[model samples]
Target: MFFWKIKKNPFDYLQKSFFFSCKPDVPSVNPFKTSKLISSYFKLGKIREAQKLFDEMTDKNVVSWSVVIHGYAINGFHSKSVELFSQMRILGFAPNSYTVVGVLVCARGLPDLVLGKSVHGVTVKSGFESNSVVGTALLGMYAECGNIFDSCKLFEGMKNPSIVSCNAMLAGYIDNELFEEGVLLFNRLRMSGFIPGESTMLTVVQGSVALESRIVAQSIHGLVVKLGLDSDMSVNNSILDLYSCCKDLDAAKKVFDMMECKDVISWTTMMGLLVNLEYAVDALNLFLKMKASKVNHDAVVIMNLVLACTVLGDLRRGRQVHSQAVICGIEYDLPLANSLITMYAKRGELQSSKTIFNQMTQKSLVSWTAIISGCLQNGHPREAMKLFMEVWVSENYSLDSALIVSALTASGVVAAFELCQQLHCYSLKAGFSHYRSVQNSVISAYANSGCMDFAQSVFEEMGCLQDLVSWNAIINGYGMNSQGEAALALYHKMRKSRGDIDRFTYSCILGACSHSGLITDGLMIFNEMVEENEVMPCQEHYGCIVDLLARAGCLSEASGFVDDCFEVMGPNALRALLSGCVLHGNVELAEVVAKKLFEQDPEESGHVVLLSNVYASVGRFQNAETLRTRMDKQRLMKNPGISSLGESSYDFG
Candidate 1:
């Protein structure tokens, strides 16, 4: 056991080390070893090492050159690959199909159509154009280069196009947003007796999703199941996306449950779909399940979760998600930050919203719009206007339709006619005046700012391009301006021209009838809305009708209507009828309606104030004083009326 080992010869060890070290310089005539070494270097991703070995080779064959070229192309050295190909040709080495493909791959990576076209000339001169492999490579190169026209032409010229070639062309159409064309091409491919592969079906599914055609998407889904591609995770995810985007949540859920393995995208897609459909509880539950399953989430998932939490007013959950986003290092993600801002703002937490907005390093149009809209909604019109001014002066932000509409709304709220006109001029200069929402907002702003002529002019200019909103805006403008006859005339014109009348249109016309004291016309239109149009009357509609009858001195008819529709007639209708009672000195009716309103909502100071005013008007001083005492005991104060003097406004506080 204690035997000593014998040492090897020093020369033998040195010779073996030398032979292994100089192996890359193997005999030039024996090109196989050099090629193998180059290939091994490439396999290890040592592309430069592979190139150095090839450069040391005294006798380089096409195989040696191809290995280096392919290494360069696959390693993202696209230009170097092309340069090597040129050098190979200059050295009088003929490029085979593999070499041509390597060069074409370089072209595809470069996305250089000019170089790809020149390669096409080389393939033609070399008589490799007819080669199936070369032809497929050329097709993919051209397609990926965004030259679909040439790709299609090359595809047609192929003697027998393979499934790979067809899939390449389909991918090109889909990637270029030519979804309809992609779908049509898939159909044509089927007609040509080519079996569609997973890639082919995936492209078709994408096209259907883009077209938003549920029918077509279902058909493709059926085909996928028939072809047994339902097991493919990518295809399954695509189907999920298709169904989610089409708003077919039931079907999307079915697909998700059937999947044996669910990825993050699957869970995210489901969560996002539920959020969009207003199923906030279900979205949160699904998100919890995803977390339980240990699925990683990206910024998009966090953004959608914030929105869901906002919808549910779950501020605690929102803050938790905010913390998670911060830990994940995506709190600064622009879209997620924007969603956080919107969530906080919607929940009346403007301080938190502004804090998040201030921390954003980069803000998109949607970001600016969200904060500006939040300010406007939170009763901070001045802040909203200030933000708009910042957006206007920033070279980084461009004025969009939403920004313009929000600014116009702020202007209208403050009744700043000069600012509104300036915004209108800017819109015209910025070429956003023709946008439908912007146009609608401009009309409303002009009307609200006491410029009826401008409102009318904007409405007229819209002409046939006017939608239902446009019609509603102009008609409401006329009604609010007390030009009720003009509003009625426009309603008649809208009825004659537009067939798809909405509830807003009817509401506007009914308001005009109430303002103008057109009782008969109002009754006729109300009947048409309920009976002919089949638009169920809401509380606003009922209030308008009651106001119309009451304002016309038809107290009995108004009372009868209120009694007939008492269950559906909300407090607004009761208040309208009560005002009519007060105006016409109908004390019995006033007492009945006031009691009903008090029983409905005792906290509404308007109701108490109206009843007190009625008692005061009739010299019932004791009753009025008693009501005032009750209001003081309840600590309820009525908002004062605002009046306008020449160039100034005052509130009777």
Candidate 2:
């Protein structure tokens, strides 16, 4: 039944019947018709029929072997094609350039670099290394196998490398994210007086975005313009993508507007750019215009619209787009589905998000990541942890670095140190322990959970990949848990590393000094912040210094500092001083602070309490009583503090 299920080759059976019944020469009488029949069967994707005709041939040569190998390779049966190549070799057929290219492509699909290299040796022995077509295939095979070393070796050894070979190496570098190398080769190719083809242009444009090389990207753009390749739609689309990825939205829009016939991809790219730049209303208007003009909406367009709905916070319109996606039958697209999940999550509709996520027949890494992040962002940290754990348990779902990072964030909420340990182990097993994002998450998770030793260890291990966020996380963690000395040490280390410290890092270190009463270090950091770092002190930065002075019992100094900077003091800075007065029982400063606080927010009963308490401490009972009477008239009561039975009880309920 399995054999009969395949379409039968009628002519082959007839020819066999004729050879058996009447005469063998009858079949040999019409060679042209027989070859056409065999070719037709192969074209129809009837591989079994084609194989049956091959078996019926009294004698087979390189031509028959080429047909089967090319057919199998084209039909995606790469393993079978490689097997056929071996069989043809055993049959004493000389492998030509065509046969080698076909089998090289099949070898590229092996997913095993060792096997690909072994087959590459065969191509070298076959004397097809000098052939441009065969050389390109070999180079592509090495590149696709993730063996860029072998690819570069092959390219360098070539006596007269064609444009195809150069382009292949350039593309290989790009695929590996070696954008600088790709750009250099592109320049060399241009300087060597070799004109780039369409593929070469696309590769360079893509590499430009990958490397964020604006100058090289502009050079490519200029070349395209000068060569009149801008009119080509494919080249224009690539240029548009390059501009968008570079965050040059203005340039991207210029390219889009200049296109004579804008496709759905162009419009979608523009809409995405608008959404990224927070022009939600403009993005929505563009979507409406696209729909009004009857441009064909593909999966990408729907994904962009879903992202727009998420940004605009228009849940009503989000549902409409979801409905349109369902009606258009593009709802099954993973990216679109993921975008919908994110949209619902952003709107605080966890139930709707979960429902859509459950309905997906096809789930990808992105789809799973969306739902996991949605749970975390929408205040369902436990659910996020649950989904993340499930993802780790499944083998088909590769553990992405982002998934681990998101889970670490959720785990740190309850200080799930055990879960953090599991992620660390997973990172080691996946050989991504040094991944920057993963290492940052480990440091942050440890730091937030008060595991300072682990945080420091992770930070120390991060030799070079520590960006501003990593340093800020560790510094802020130390400040939060009252490790002022350690925080200051890290800030100095960051400065030594030539790291450009931002306001967050400074604010964190200043806060540490305020709480720990490090007056000298605080002053030094403050001076450096203003003069050396050249970071204009925000109100928060200034407030930290005032609070630090107040904590150190430098009341007159604090008051002088506040007076000197009264013009620059924001409302929060004034409140910080009022808090300092309450801490130090300074009724004189409290009196001046009360007037500022009351003017800032007359309804704040806490400031009244602060003023009354300050007055009571100074034996001015009548003033204190008058403050109480004003509080009664305002009808605002101070919030009483509540005590829990046990600290551990808070974790569960």
Best by lDDT: 1
Query: Per-model C-alpha lDDT, please?
Result: 0.87, 0.81
For candidate 2, list the clashing residue pairs, or say none: none
Worst 10-residue lDDT window, candidate 1? 1-10
What tens digits encode model 2's per-residue C-alpha lDDT throughout 112-187?
5776777677777887778888888888888888889889888988888887888889988998888888888788
Can you tell me which runs of candidate 1 are displaced by over 4 Å?
Answer: 1-146, 291-298, 398-400, 411-435, 450-464, 514-520, 527-533, 545-653
Candidate 1 residue 95 Cα shift, in angstroms, is: 7.7
Q: Which residue pairs collide, candidate 1?
A: none
Query: In model 2, which runs have C-alpha deviations exceeding 4 angstroms?
Result: 1-49, 52-59, 111-130, 147-166, 428-433, 484-503, 506-653
Cα miss at 441, model 1 (Å)? Answer: 3.6
What TM-scores do the predictions have? 0.75, 0.73
The TM-score obtained by model 2 is 0.73
lDDT at position 233, candidate 2: 83
In candidate 2, residue 334 scores what lDDT? 85
Worst 10 residues of 2 by lDDT: 642-651
